[model samples]
Target: MSAPETTTTTALMPMVIGEHRIAVEALSVLEILGPQQWVAIPNTPPMLPGALAWRGRAVGVLDLGPALDLPTLSAPSTRNRNAILQLTDDTVALSVDRVLEVCRAAADAIAPVHAASWVVDGGLPCRGEIELDELVVPILDLDAWAVASRRAR
Candidate 1:
């Protein structure tokens, strides 16, 4: 077979989590939510920061910061957005700093990660750029995270 092409016509919808940036397939995002009141839950992991009341249901929130065991880039007073995943079976919201404009990139542009991160062990893809915003960001694997969360419980 001949060599494959280098570019693809697709783009990605990425969000800034704390200071790190990541992309979830545009189709995977249910909606982008603004800041809201967070209620703490007892005996939960640090990543499970709290829960939010939404549409008559309580949605658990996950903070990518502790989820990856990475310190907040700048004490997150400005990073205050949440990306709700299109969960086919559970309820959880990913607390990010903000959502940026969708950008175009090839599948090969997603660099691999080699270092350590709690999230990586949990379900973060071993691939994706880490040094986004000068900080190591573990691009999350939503499907894997869901699976791990269930296993953790």
Candidate 2:
């Protein structure tokens, strides 16, 4: 059987990383599961915090805070909930603290910033200079984050 043809639309989902607010591509998300029981992996990268027994599959959990240099949690506490982002063929499920809402913006909305001192500023493809009044949120590059996490291991 042949796969169905589909048209793609661009939209942004508001997500919270620790205290900072950010906007992520809505298409990158799989599902937002509740606080799940996870098994801690030894000697793994801090970004790849651990793995969770999700649907009989060992889903690699990415700690958004640590991955983005935000404050680390006191412990592995997912008591509230998390947004699971499917990155790179949905093989990895990244966990974020909260989901604010979804909004739409133009691709040209992203602009480059001049500051190149900070590591994140340097690494980002676009600096995101102009802030949207209704959808102003930090842009996160999951690909870069995943790579950094692996190298940190």
Q: Which parts of model 2 are misplaced by more than 4 Å?
A: 1-9, 67-69, 73-76, 113-136, 148-153
**If scored against the real structure, what TM-score would every candidate get?**
0.70, 0.71
Q: Cα RMSD to native, each candidate?
A: 4.9, 6.4
Q: Considering every candidate listed, which one attains the maximal lDDT?
A: 1
Query: Each candidate's lDDT (Cα)?
Result: 0.63, 0.60
Lowest summed lDDT across 10 adjacent residues in model 1 is found at 70-79
Model 1, span 55-133: residue lDDT tens: 7888878766764456632322313677777656776777777787765656665567654355466446434543434
